[model samples]
Target: MQLNLTGHHIEITDSLRNYVDEKMERIERHFDKVTNTHVILTVENVRHKAEATVNMRGNNIFAESTEDNMYAAIDSLTDKLDRQVKKHKEKITDHHQKESIPLVDTEEE
Candidate 1:
């Protein structure tokens, strides 16, 4: 999957970028259909915010977290995104199962 990292008011360092990339890579094991990911990091006052947008087959999952550290924020955001992805996948699987299964009827004459 393609990962795009952007910063708002802060300059993104190599280590920071690498850290974000690594963290995002962990989510790939959960769903391999991820096309691309957009990550935005912003530092405002005492709050560091990290937001990530994951593009899946026909769905878009987004998660944002704010913390005192950029890495921590990214971690939290990714955790949230993982949960969202899992939930979405489960829903899709359930729907497909229900749709594919045909009801059987038994009649007595």
Candidate 2:
């Protein structure tokens, strides 16, 4: 999966970039079809905010969190995104299962 990191009003440091990459890598294990991911980090006053958008085959998952620390914000964001991905996966699988079955036709005796 491709990861694009952006900073708004905050400098993108190597350590922060590496931390984001590592956390996003863990998401690959859960969903292999992830096309791309975009992460935006912003700091406003004392609040650090992290937002992540995951692009999948048929759907997109997004999550955001704000905390005092950037690391904590990222952690919370990813956790929320993980839950969204899992829920979406389950919904998609369930939908396919119900739609894939064909109805049988009976002949009148």
Give me the candidate number with maximum lDDT. 2
Candidate 1, residue 10: the lDDT equals: 94
Model 2 is weakest, by summed lDDT over 10 consecutive residues, at: 93-102
lDDT of 1 by residue, 1-109 (tens): 9999999999999999999888888788888889999999999998999998999997999999999998889889999999988888887774543445547765677
Give the CA lDDT, 0 to 100, for residue 32 in model 2: 89
Off by over 4 Å in 1: 94-109
- For model 2, what is the C-alpha lDDT against the true structure? 0.91
* Residue pairs that clash (backbone atoms under 3 angstroms), model 2: none
Cand. 2 TM to true fold:
0.84
Task: Quote the lDDT for 4 in model 2.
Answer: 97
Clashes of each: 0, 0
List, residue by residue over 1-109, the lDDT tens digit for candidate 2: 9999999999999999999998987787888899999999999999999998999999988889999999999999989988888887887775544555547866698
Provide the overall lDDT of each model, using Cα atoms, as 2-decimal numbers.
Answer: 0.90, 0.91
| Candidate 1 similarity to native, TM-score | 0.83
